[model samples]
Target: MRFATVLAVPATILGAASAATTVPVTYEPKYDNGNFSLLGTACSDGQNGLVTKHYDTAGSLPSFPNVGGAFTVSGWNSSDCGSCYQLTWQNNSIYITAIDVTQQGFNIALAAMNNLTGNLAVQLGRVSASYDPADGSKCGF
Candidate 1:
């Protein structure tokens, strides 16, 4: 009887081990392959006359514009207060850069779109000092 008990213990242990799910974890928890693209769109807070550009993409990591291969251009946050955002990439990497308003003009145009606010543009050191759009000389604005 004692001999049978010993055999039963080992057999039970072996059965449990073999019965475990045959999942492919690779010690990696999960697996992923990279390939990607981005789609950009512009949205406006029309009531406030503010336009925002949005970029969204799925695919993999190596296809971003001007960003390089393997080294992903994903995952980013702008530390520049007022203007900030975060980006995530499949390669588990990150890159952060300023959103140049001058190039897109979305942000600047939003500010100018409101006729009421356009009046204030002259005071915020805009178009040089004293809000003189026609002044040939720089007012250190």
Candidate 2:
């Protein structure tokens, strides 16, 4: 019985460790040209092209531009770029590609913010959300 109890403890700990991580989410208005170039996007050059082709099939601007990869600014790297996550806020969820890194949480695109907030982006500039890894095959994973 003692061995079984010990096994349960490690299983519980592992479950907690693997749980989805939640983070703050904010919005950024689109650039004048309706692109994310001015923000010094890290993945805009090549990875973004692949991201767009995979996710932006509706002919709309890509969503979820900024992400706190590894949950820190300095922690972000090329490997984190172009990663995809499913962000959940309230009862809404949206898939976002990690085009840039941010220390202020996941800085989403304005269009995505609107969609997630039911067109309340103007009223709610920031919110708490959780993210989980999505299928990255389309993102060249």
For every candidate structure, what is the RMSD over all alpha carbons to the true structure, in angstroms?
25.0, 6.0
Worst 10 residues of 1 by lDDT: 23-32
Off by over 4 Å in 2: 1-18, 31-33, 45-77, 137-141
Candidate 1 matches the true fold with a TM-score of 0.15
Best lDDT among the predictions, by candidate number: 2
Model 1: per-residue Cα lDDT over 9-112, one tens digit each = 67777687344322110010011111222222111112211122222221121222212111111122212211222222221212211122122111222222
What lDDT does model 1 reach? Answer: 0.21
lDDT of 2 by residue, 22-99 (tens): 888887664212433423554443433424334322123343332323243233235656667778778698777666
Error of 2 at 128 (Å): 0.2
Model 2: what TM-score? 0.61
